[model samples]
Target: MFLIVKSLMLVLMILMVLILVLNLCSMKTFYDKEKNSPFECGFDPKSNSRTPFSLQFFLIAIIFLIFDVEIALLLPIIKTYNMDNITLIITSNFFIIILLLGLIHEWNQGALNWLK
Candidate 1:
């Protein structure tokens, strides 16, 4: 126990010395304005860099991601079908039902509407 404690204290001291040396060596004293701004071939930008995004496209992408992940999860059930477990089958079915219900809810809420 005494040897372990001594080794740990040595490691801690070495780490502290390393951190202090790094902190003292790395310093940034200067900042340039032109270096930070977005470049447009040496010409001043004509428009704002930030633009508003479409919320409808964002929602559609999110829904697509959710369904994609659920499809991946459902694919494993095909491998488990050969097993002799009734509970596994029931659980997989229940998961599918939940996914369908979520889809129905999203549909009813008009989240799937792209035309509006």
Candidate 2:
């Protein structure tokens, strides 16, 4: 315990010293114009950086990400279920039901429709 505490203190001191050195070295002079401007190779930019985005597309992407993550989460539960854990199975089932209900709600609300 003594050695562990000593080592941790040493690590903390080293980190503190490094952070101080970095803070001292990272000061920048006033050069905001160059920092804010886009880099131009020999040619000019064809289009503006800030373009209008479709809300529908964004919604679909968010839904896809949510479901994709849910699928990944479900996979681990599935692997664990093979070990014959009854409580986990019921919990997983409840979780799936909730997901299905959410999906149904979205479907009813026309969120799944592409043209909406």
TM-scores, each model vs. reference: 0.53, 0.53
lDDT by residue for model 2 (2-100), tens: 999999999999999999999889866568876656665432345764566677878888989998898889878866665567788788999899889
Flag regions of model 2 displaced more than 4 Å: 1-45, 81-85
Q: What is the C-alpha lDDT of each candidate?
A: 0.85, 0.81
Model 2 residue 6 CA deviation (Å) reads 40
Clashing pairs in 2: none
What stretches of model 1 exceed 4 Å from their correct place? 1-47, 80-82
Residue pairs that clash (backbone atoms under 3 angstroms), model 1: none
